[model samples]
Target chain A: MTIEQIRKTFDSFLEEHLAFGQPEGLYEPLHYLMKQGGKRLRPLLLLLATGLYDDRFERGLHAALAVELFHNFTLAHDDIMDEAATRRGKPTIYKKYGLPSGILTGDLALIYAYEQLVMGLPASLAIRLMAIFNGFAVDVCRGQQLDMEFEMREHIRMEEYLQMIAWKTAVLPAGALQIGALIGGASEEEAAILHRFGLQLGLAFQLQDDWLDTFGDEQKTGKRKGGDILQQKKTALVVYVLEHGSPEQARHLLEALKSDELQDAEKIAAVQGFLEVSGAKAAIDELQRKYTREALAQLASLNLPEARLQPLKMLAEELMGRKG
Target chain B: MTIEQIRKTFDSFLEEHLAFGQPEGLYEPLHYLMKQGGKRLRPLLLLLATGLYDDRFERGLHAALAVELFHNFTLAHDDIMDEAATRRGKPTIYKKYGLPSGILTGDLALIYAYEQLVMGLPASLAIRLMAIFNGFAVDVCRGQQLDMEFEMREHIRMEEYLQMIAWKTAVLPAGALQIGALIGGASEEEAAILHRFGLQLGLAFQLQDDWLDTFGDEQKTGKRKGGDILQQKKTALVVYVLEHGSPEQARHLLEALKSDELQDAEKIAAVQGFLEVSGAKAAIDELQRKYTREALAQLASLNLPEARLQPLKMLAEELMGRKG
Candidate 1:
């Protein structure tokens, strides 16, 4: 099936799976947030990875849903941790429901996600999947803790930022791909390679997202222009400018970051100007492109049939180039 | 193993397991709370359940560890949700390490707990344990949410209060017993019966705990005298009194609950007086005794040899009568 057909089917399963819980007051915030919906990327990756190995990818649907549900669980809780006001162009779960309800709901979603996985697979596969999922869950939490720590530090290196994104956003998808491949009867080494490919691609995807938040069109990105600048996020572009820019440019950028009273327009102009003049945006683009190349290289090393690999390569390009 | 021996083993495991991650800023709070120590009641239940079938309970130490880690995970997150100042005579994780760190660290502990469980059991047992653990996890969250809900409502029935405690504090032990039984090769029916026994006993345990919270010596409980009264908790005793008290007593109780000037001493006295005049304390004791008797009946029905059951029975009585 095509990516659209796969996405539609996966989205249907996610909705069906998420709706199976009892809707007491405790679950209100969780249900609200899980239904708010994001890109459904991890589930799609699982589905696609399995399909790449076998035409009968439907056999892996339960695994796909498990990854998706787990991903949403992390998002729900992460929103609480980040004190995020919005997600997916909507008010966040914590914003809509109080912190306590949001936390409990996130927890329920996580437990149920494991239930979904174990319900379908053999005990052996289910156990392995759970172990892998558990590892990913810990990595996500660690990445988040580091992200919180980064907030307290004065300067965050680009490498540190990359490592954090790799942990936070990349590993879950990487795990999903590897597990899906394993379920589809891929060799262990091949699965490991695919996991690396997915991790690199996921990291590149986040870097592109950071770049788009600063440089892409407001209408396309679906938020205010320069929103990240206004928030003074230490994205790759910001780190590049901080380290590489002229003294005056650094002063201007730091002034924007330091000043609580800086107008949104001024902060945006200062950071954006520094990024453009310092070639940070170009460097970011190059970094993203490099990872995309690495991801494709890793995928090619899997030595799968061309038809099976084509869809994934296309997905990588789509993810890297997309506005949102 | 004896309780002291089990405690020593668990203490060593806690140290080794918690030391796996970086023990810096974000992780320090989690380590502090987890290592602060409790009675290790849940793990003990797991081990005891296993011992009912075989002395090979040593093989299930990781599974038992899963119980304690999950318990600690709940406490860490719950401390944040309750905005609690202290736990176990020490400052709470959130209070010590800020809310975000506490949330992430607690999350990691939970993931690691499941990881440990899967490591100990085969896939089938692991999956079943996960499903049971997840179910217990949901009930725990639901109970907490209901509890938060209870704080706002003035009149909660004793029956509802009983159900809430069963969900909140009791299910984990029930699950621990059931999981242990299953791992020890008990029949599903037998495991389930033991689970029910544990649940009922835990319910009785919580009610009796409320009794001790008000009446037990400060040195024994290791908390402030009448701490629950200071918070105006609607414990089983309070709910019983509030429901059955005469209009005059109810009026005085309501006045005490509403008064900002109500000192800890006054609230305790008011609660004590209401319990006495309304015969609520006796009523709660009777209810606790009835549940305890019922739980013992269930345990008897398990058909274990009296030699094997003796310790558990004695422990139950000790739990029922303990001042702390």
Candidate 2:
């Protein structure tokens, strides 16, 4: 089946699996959030990765469901922790259901996700999949902690910023790819390579997101430019300028951040100016390119039939080729 | 090994295994909660259940850690949801570190728990244990939801109250015993029987706790009497009285609860009087006795060597022998 068909089928699978549970109060919010879909990036990535080794990619549907459910569980809890108002352009679970349901929904979603990890898989594969997923799960928490810490911290190094993004945004898709590949009967070595490919791909995607949040058109990216500036989020660009820029540049950036006289647009402009002049933008641009190049190299090294690899290749270009 | 020895070793095992993780902020509160140490009853019960069929009960230590960690995970989050100030005579995680840590700690503890379930076990058993645990974890969430519902709810049926308590308090120890028995190579039937034993035992224990909170001496129970009453918690005793009492008795109970004139001690006296006269107290007592008897019968049916079963028998006697 085509990717589009698979996605439709996945929606059916997700609803059929998690839509019903007793105590409607505890479950309706979870189903509500699941229905309010994102890109379904993690599960689709897993399914695509599994297709690399096996033609019957549908067999990995359970693993795909597990990844998606687990990802959504994090989102529900993270929304609560972040006090986020909307997800997928709609009210978050915590906002709609109140705090207790918010917490309970996330908890229950996570428990259900664990069952999916080994739900129908054989014993040895289930254990290995669990080991991989557990490590990834803990790392995600560490990343989240660091991100929250960065918000409260006075200063952050570039490496620390990267670490936070790697954990928060990068490893999830990477993990999905690795688990899917493993489930598709890929060798550990092959799956490891696919994981590296996913890491580079994910890193490039996150960097592009950071770039788009700053430099891309509001009309195109669909987000107002320089939201990170307004929130004082220490994105990779912000950290690079702070950690590596000259004192004047550093002072200018901080002043742009703290000064009341400048309007939000002016403040964003000032930060953008610093990014351009300090060459952090160019460096980050080059870094994204490097990541994309590395990701492509890994995918190419797999030596799979081109017909089999075409979808992932096309995905790489589609994700990276967007203008920023 | 003696049960006491197993408990000590379990503590050491828990520390050595879970004491290490990066991002100290995320791991510290988890370590802190695990350190504060409740009775460690679940793990000990699991180890003893394992011993019922196998002498190498220590091999079940990882499963013991998993159950204990999962239990603590619940307690940490529950404290947040309950807005509890203290647990085990100390400030709770949320109380000490704040809300984010409270939620994140529970999340991390649970993820770490999934790891422990299969950390050393063979694949098939590991999968079975996970399947069992996932159900228990979800039920606990359902139970907690019901509890919150019961709080706001004006009228609760007897069956719903029993369902809430069974989910919230009873299934945890039951799941532990069943898992340990499985690891010890008990047949599904034997493990199922052990689970039933634990269910009845846990229910009886919770009922006794309710009874002790209301009727046991302050010196013996060590809690402020009528805290549940003051909070209007729907414990078995309260639910029974509401469900089975005469209309006058029910109205009198509500009046005592709502009246501003009565002092705290007077409210306690009034409720205790209602419990004594309404036959609810006697009924709950009989129910507790029946559960204990059933639990004992399940244990006796195992027909193990007396020496092997003696410790669990002693535990049953000690727990059930408490005065209220």
Candidate 3:
């Protein structure tokens, strides 16, 4: 049940088994993007949850892989849409392989995710998994579409951003956890509780991500410092400052957001200064802690033996405080 | 059995039962792309094949829609890869929504195609459908990857081109007809026969498309005359010409392909001239006729009443010869 043990197992599964076919130029970009490491957190969570109940974790490996592959698929396609040139300090799949290959590879990943999900489940369970898997995919698309719409808008409400991320980033993990529980022979109540636990964890995870983009150690995060600030992203921190700042302070923040000529350091300092005075950082910290606490509480409410749930609780705490 | 009736049934089924949440931007690009006009030949084939048994073709509407939607999904992504600005005289989905939304919409379409298949079949049949659907999707991706490889090669072999096209464009329709037959309660042997029927028709359909690109009247075909020649596509005609043309003609063809300096009209005429003189036109025409006759013959060989399959036979004849 140790987090390290769970991650080791997941990585071995990916490395040994995920050898998809190449379609010349089309596959290289997607392959390149996926090979660039993420934390492998989503799939790890599913494995941990499944292992929580049954010792038979390997049976659910394809389900976990399905989530990871789908996550990478979204990343590849989103990079193309956002015109992002690099991911994790290297060229993005689209940049490396061009738009068509990026699109096709992303597509292959998605279709293959479904293929993997169907490999191990019983017929009735497979239908349920199909519904869950397909629903996650459709919601991710909906969220990306909304994210695009947000880009063109002059202002975005906090609720809208939360809803968007819930659809885009949160639900896949939640759905995956549910599938993991189902496959592991957990009762329906246990499955629903676990699903909520993963979702809340995801929400907190995303908020922490937004916070790290501004204040994180560049060595750990491996992104250009203040990158989101330079882009004038309508993130949670910005939304909080805009809604709560004094009238004059709000005007300064708005002017800074709209000004294209501000230097990178100056922009970051200006926005950070405004957010500090507005107490936006404190508000976000409080909100993040609330969600994290709620997620842990949900985990504790599961009637499963505490020893079985020990690894998940430790993993959740680490995720909340993670620097990268 | 009428095409108009089949279209109506498919449209009604899609509108009434897709179970898709009305997300704001999710379906916009797909709606835009699907509404643009083309002959819905793939779906029509499924409906016609179903009619070969009984008027229970209505039960197969969602399955047929899956085929068409999957086709358009590939088209949308392919347009992005090919950098095609226009499709059917309108801007393609990528050009309209940009790569991110285009990619997301295409992914959504592919998943929804699976959903439609699941919904249209019984649980027992749904499991079988997923098995077939997964294999078809993987093959399509591999074909697309190989096609990108073809674009970069100076002299792609004819066998490779056929393999690529069979995987890329032909297999889905081939699978779709068989799925239709299965949905309508045809035996495994009967389904296999219809599958061969569809595959042959698909091959002839693609070959005829290649022929029409150069030889059809510009006024009748919406596409610009000699469009494939201008693009230097390694089509069947070009392959034949490259293999059989005299040394001087081959050199001219190579020069046209390598040099961007040749004016569009001049390049088109040069390629056309080489095709004619080398008898590549006659050779390809004979090949197209061979497949067409074989496809119709396969249709006749199906152990069904003649009246039941007459509509499909007529549709194939029109498809092979029609300019638009």
**For model 2, what is the alpha-carbon lDDT of residue A218?**
78
Q: Which of the two, 1 or 2, has more DockQ?
A: 2
Please tell me which model should have the higher TM-score, number 1 or number 2: 2
lDDT of 3: 0.79
Q: In model 1, which runs have C-alpha deviations exceeding 4 angstroms?
A: A19-23, A242-252, A259-262, B217-223, B245-252, B261-263
lDDT of 3 by residue, A19-47 (tens): 55645555555567567888888788788
Docking class of 3: medium
Off by over 4 Å in 2: none
- Give TM-score values for chain A, per-prediction: 0.93, 0.96, 0.93
Instruction: For each candidate, give its TM-score against the true structure.
Output: 0.94, 0.98, 0.93
Flag regions of model 3 displaced more than 4 Å. Answer: A20-30, A217-225, A260-262, B15-23, B218-224, B246-248, B256-267
- lDDT, residue B6, model 3: 78
Each candidate's lDDT (Cα)?
0.80, 0.85, 0.79
Flag the better candidate by lDDT, 1 or 3: 1
**What's the CA error at residue B57 for candidate 1, in Å?**
2.1
Worst ten-residue run, lDDT, model 1 chain A?
A14-23
Q: Which lDDT value does model 1 have at B88?
A: 69
Candidate 2 per-residue lDDT, tens place, B129-150, comes to: 9989998999899899988888
